[model samples]
Target: MPTGVAIRDPREQLFNAAERVLLRDGPSALTSRAVTTEAGCAKGVLHRHFTDFDAFLAELVRDRIARLDATALLTSAGSGVVSHHLTVALTDLFGSVAVAIVSLVISRDELRARLRRTTPTGIPLLTEAAAMLGSYLAVERELGRIDAGCDLHVLATTLIGAAHMLFADRTGTPPDGTAVRRVVDSVIVGALSTPPR
Candidate 1:
């Protein structure tokens, strides 16, 4: 077997490798052999850890969602310009890696079913992202950065929906960080009233 990092967690290593493959080569290039090679592990290593490729993918998606959730929580807690923080969070989610995974899951029925089985109660990443943004907006509202009467859930969904479209666009060059920030800022400005002078 090939050797690589001395990390204790094989699953994490595999997940990281899989993510690299997805981002660098796109979803079609992702395979058990590719992941194991990227991780510098034996071909059977992935099977040893996960039931199969679909199960592994489901776990990977869940892990990424959990990471995004953590980021949202941290951003909400940090002291900074609310719009900047939100822009950063949404941009993170709209990266190539995320877009690739989301595209793969949507087009693959087996993987989608596996994911649904894995996460029964909670929403998928997109819905979860909207909820995270909504939670952050609620925090901003409490801090008087958002309008008191604004519908946070709707605002969050709208922002996420718009960002999703931009991220999922493949015909032209994807929006860069600055463009994403501008979109996020516009959403925030529209949702918030002017602060009392």
Candidate 2:
């Protein structure tokens, strides 16, 4: 057993266990039984906490999105090289756990509908990411790092779309940090105007 697993709230324990199962065995293996088994709790524990498996999954997805939002909040522009900051933020956002959760949600319609009903705005994670990226780019533009003429929304959307593909390419291992940085640099440079020579 892990250090904190035994002490945390039951909901958190279940969530963490579900994430572990998803990451270790992929989305198909993330059943209520698997989650409870990994959590070292009874099968009925999840039912007692959440309305059903879909409800639990919905809450888990929302919790993960909230965590990603918190991470985005830490990525302020002008604090570091904008491309590097953006790369790090995107990499964290598209991590293997996130990818697994997304895959599960896409394959499970009941969970998807549950999530849509529970979230206030019903906006998906990718849209939220794009919005965060756009805000970061706007701040960078104000600091003169990005071109004034560049459309922040379009650039953010493009970056998010590319990142989606990069993350979805689970053919073998994920793209390394160097590859992610190169892609971020290319995107940023293409969107920025040449400085005065």
Candidate 3:
């Protein structure tokens, strides 16, 4: 690990280093200097790949999103057990991508200086995750496993919001399976009560 001279291609090495830096140091450590240092590259390498800080952050988010999406896929379509998925997917995202997202969103200065341009305009991650839930709900609703009227939209929104809040530690504690289950079940049952005919 020689400084100023990288071992592998700087691009791959930097991306790998970015993940390591993000995990060990969180989103706050994702500066060009920090990432290059971690990757054993000169500071200019970041600029060579990305146009600016915003571009780098954007790439970081993209990197994280891909990983989370893969995780959600693995969690996969199952029993539509909200508690199960919540325990696995949301919690996992919180620890990983969501940590960076939350950290960026929480800090006004950081959000403006580093995140505003890079971060998506709205809850893209949540929307994606919710859509995952919505897919499950669609199946459940079709099978009559859950309520038909559950407004998958609302359920998705609620789940994403609750998940974000929980991950941000806004509640002062990580949300538990029971709580997630209860809310999800309530929505399902409510949706079920509506006349499907």
lDDT of 3 at 117: 48
Candidate 2: the clashing residue pairs are none
TM match of model 2 to true structure: 0.83
Report the Cα lDDT for residue 107, model 2: 84
Kindly list the per-residue Cα lDDT of model 3 for residues 25-122, writing each as its tens digit.
76666778888889877778889888876676666655555555544533444454444554565566665546555564454353344544444455
Which residue runs of candidate 3 sit more than 4 Å off their true CA positions? Answer: 1-9, 19-29, 70-82, 105-121, 170-189, 192-197
lDDT of 2 by residue, 1-197 (tens): 55333435899999999999988888889999999999998888899899989889989988887766634534566665677787888898887477777788878978877777655342457666787888878877887778989998889888877777788754458887787777777777867654311
Using TM-score as the measure, name the better of candidate 2 and candidate 3: 2
- Among these predicted structures, which one has the highest TM-score? 2
The 0-to-1 C-alpha lDDT of every candidate, in the order given, reads: 0.78, 0.77, 0.60
RMSD to true structure for each model, in Å = 3.7, 4.3, 5.0
lDDT of 3 at 95: 55
The residue ranges of model 1 lying beyond 4 angstroms of the native Cα positions read 1-7, 69-80, 118-123, 169-174, 195-197
Query: Better model by lDDT, 2 or 3?
Result: 2
Could you tell me how far off, in angstroms, the CA of residue 101 lies in candidate 2 after the best superposition?
Answer: 1.2
